[model samples]
Target: MTTEITARDKLLLYVVGMFAFIFFFVQFMLIPALSASDQAAADLAVAQQAQIAMQDTIALSGTNAAAKTESWAALQQANASYYGLLSSSDLDTLVSNLELGHNLAPLSLEISSINTQSLTGYAASDKAEDTAAPGEIDSSDPTLATADTNAVLMELAPPLTRVYASADYFKACTVTFRCTGSDSDFYTMLDDLAGQYPSVQLRSVQIDHAAYTDASGTTTGTATFTVQLSVILCDKESVAS
Candidate 1:
């Protein structure tokens, strides 16, 4: 036997159907959209981080390039402050100045000896150029012949040795001199020498308080100074070559 439909029952069935439709809409459409939006936001954050890292790397590279340029400029300025190899006339002028340029009296001045020394492996380049084969590099080639000369002399590390050895070599000389002067005058002369010629190195100094007694019976003081100096010379420009 079938039961007859009632208005209240029909109204209840309609209400339940509407509630089920709303639940399915939230679960299938709204929730998935929200989840996809969150995933997109996470991907954008990762992309932004990658972009920031690339910008930082580019900035670091630029800073390094600028630093290298500054270092090169400083090196060039330091090289410019040096006096390269001296000629015969230059030596004569130097000696004259030492003897007469100051208030002190120079009794003797002499260059005892000059010896060849290597600032780098290129020290023997002059000899090599002299005995070079016909097919080998000639003196006209600037690559092997030119010198970026300087007077500062010191032992070099392997990397610097290769750098300097490409062009120049060093030669050193022993300079001995005796002079009669007051203590103040002696020190002044030394200061003058250092300012004018950065290459001159003071090796030793000896002072005698009562070195001489003249006919007037007045005592005089004397000082002896020994110095070593170096000059950078090119293979093709050297006299021996």
Candidate 2:
């Protein structure tokens, strides 16, 4: 038998079915969709940050390139200036100019002997000379016997002087020189030589005469001053080597 449905019962069934549909939609579809949208927004933000970082790196690289170019230009200018000065002047002229500028005089100078000792090997000859009143060799009394002997000795020799002539790289050279002038002149000479000649050094300064007064004739004692100087030759190559 079929029972007739009442209006209230029908209304109650409709309300319950509507509630169940709403709950299923919220739990299974709407919440997951909202969560996926939020994750997408976070990923987009990270991508934007990476792009900004990349742009900053590119800008910094450009700045470094500009700085390097400026430094290169400055170095080129400095090298040009140095070369221009070097090309315009000779060694002797530069030295003389420096001396005059520093109020120094190039006094009497001399280069002493340069020597070198080396080991050399020699061979000995086993032939005896018969000096019988100019009769050098007698009739072969059984052919003369010859023997070879090796020997070594120390040889006192002169070094290559031209090698030391280079002003660029001077080797060891002993400069036995004399300078006679006032105290100021002497000191100025020292300064000038040290500044101009990179290979010149003051080894010893022998005071031949100091400031003394000759009072034999006049009552007022007037002093005559002089300085005797000797310099040694020092070269960059010698020091470096």
Best-matching candidate per lDDT: 1
Candidate 1 lDDT by residue in tens digits, 1-241: 9997899999999999999998999999999999999999999999999999999989899897777567555655555555445565565567657756676676666664444443333423445645322223344554543343432121221233343453243455556666666777778777887787665655557776657789999987666543333333222222110
lDDT by residue (1-241, candidate 2, tens digit) is: 9999999999999999999999999999999999999999999999999999999989899897777567545534432322111211233344455445644455544443432211010001113322121122332332431221001000110121233332212122234433344567656666766665543344455545544445665343221222222222222222110
What TM value does model 1 have? Answer: 0.44
Candidate 2: what lDDT?
0.43
Which sections of candidate 2 miss by over 4 Å? 1-7, 56-63, 72-241
C-alpha local distance difference test of each model:
0.57, 0.43
Local lDDT at 11 for model 1: 92
Evaluated against the true structure, the overall lDDT of model 1 is 0.57
Q: What is the lDDT of residue 222 in candidate 1?
A: 62
Clash-forming residue pairs, model 2: none
